[model samples]
Target: MTKKGDQRQAEELDPRKQTILKAVVDDYVETAEPVGSESLLQRYPLGVKPATVRNEMATISDMGYLHQPHTSAGRAPTHRGYRYYVDRLAEPMNEDEARQIARRLAKTVESQPEMVTATLRMLSGITRYAAVATTARDQSLKLLKCVVTPLTRGRALMMCAFDNGSVDSHVVDLGSALSAQQMRRLNASIAKLVEGQQAAEVVALKLSLPVVEDRFLQDAIARTLRAAQSSARVATRGELYYEGILKMMEHVEFQRSLESLEQVLGALQDKHRVYDAMEQTPENELSVMVGEENPVPELQNCSMVVARYKAGKREGGVIGVVGPARMRYSETLPLVQQMARSLSGVLAKLIEE
Candidate 1:
């Protein structure tokens, strides 16, 4: 149904109806079993008797918030029911849980990549679902050093070093011979231009041929700098890291989504596709996209609980858990949020050191 229709229906529900709907969603999430009126009255302290509870469950099912799989079976939450619970009924996860998540992430890792891997590993273990981490699209590419070597007449090799410990080199055809002193000067000037700036910022930079007296020297430096900037931007494809695919497979819903599982795994392995999934929802806010609500067809049977984390300084990235739609939202939602914040802190600390 449309957003307007969903809202209108929500508004029409009285307090009693809303309370029953919340109870049904919460119970179904916990047990992954259908909730009958008898179960509701038995579990909750609602003063209503069994008949009234049954009537309300029937009404909610009729209103598209709940579904009954069989004639004698109990009713379970539909996608709309889950949506309503997330938007209105779900309570914030507590302070103690948040503290535990933070402490777990504070442990040291060897490098930025390891920190990312560890983040997903910890999150998957905590949530019992497939956890994924996508690095920030933009990272400040800090230049560390530049070297120019004479390969042959009218040609030289330029090697640029970045703070990330990766080196890139390309050959520049000077169109004329260059001296060792001139090569040193070219390297120094290039470093001075981009040492502290971001990759994007320096890529658009215009260099001066008049910076040096010799035309061959100036031309060589310009070509080399362009090569370095291009290389940096090309390396900006964010890395995709995932864990606990098997853990999630332990659930029944994913098992039923068997044919779609291969497609989902393929998408996970492709960072661009993972980034697309991350961008499907807005940044910073935690979201629960259930069943048909998922943008990807392969994930239509699955539910994704995603949140964003800071990559370090200016830009941020995304992380989250993907599990069956029957996932316990009350348990999973806050954990994902806390883990994202912890990941941001870890990456920031890594950047500082």
Candidate 2:
């Protein structure tokens, strides 16, 4: 049978077998222990004899959905079992719950990067899983304004505001203070060099030092330009923000095998790998990749629930939750789906203002 046909077969399981499989999965997810027929019957209304339940479980295990870790032990859901179970879940976030969560995230963050960081932190906090997100600022967005604010201790702050509602700023050590007249001149010259230019253009621009020859002002301008260019490259590639790695470690799956945890964390630490994984979910869609479905070798033993959000007509970003295959799909799935929609709404409003 084709893959879809196989999934259909799993879905079309007899009602009794389906009930047994669901009970095993739910019990294993909660207790992290293989579930025997007696244990399942005690907790769930299987409405079948002990012998019948054990026979059905054995049949289910033969179908490759459940596996006996030891010869005489109870069964647990395999990766395929998780896939089948997650595919059948249709839970949606409650309307009031969505409103409360969206209201909490409605407070505007200062910039695109700040918004991504804030979203990821909230996602991790809620799900107790590692969360990751990408920032989706376009590389071709023009620089709208450049502001230089003088600070004490031979320092000044330079902020570059882009047309797409993103801001990049850096603080520089001027090595000397600039008079108001000199600061004004520096601002004008800097603006002329970069205002209305695309981020990539500014990054690649060959600077012709401005007319005023104050050495300190010139050096500060050079530092600011370099910082802006660096920021542009990071923004263009969709800079990644992640949180809650420590929280994820509390799970039984990770606590049992530190090496396995390290391997997954190592893969996540690679920006390219994370971006590639996040890109698998198309724009405005939700994806649930269970263990072994993930392309990254290190992540093959992990599960990911991802959704993409659009900030503009074409530019988009991804947010995701990563955890073990036994993750609470009933809870995590709706949370991820709702958070992604809420984030997109917040970004849309931010761009409007």
**Quick one: best lDDT, which candidate?**
2
Lowest-lDDT window of 10 residues in candidate 2?
A: 1-10
Worst 10-residue lDDT window, candidate 1:
1-10
lDDT of each: 0.75, 0.79
RMSD in angstroms, candidate 2? 12.3
Model 2, global lDDT: 0.79
On residues 39-94, what C-alpha lDDT tens digit does candidate 2 reach at each position?
89899998889999989988888888999999888999998888877876435778
* Candidate 1 ranges beyond 4 A from true positions: 1-12, 138-236, 260-267
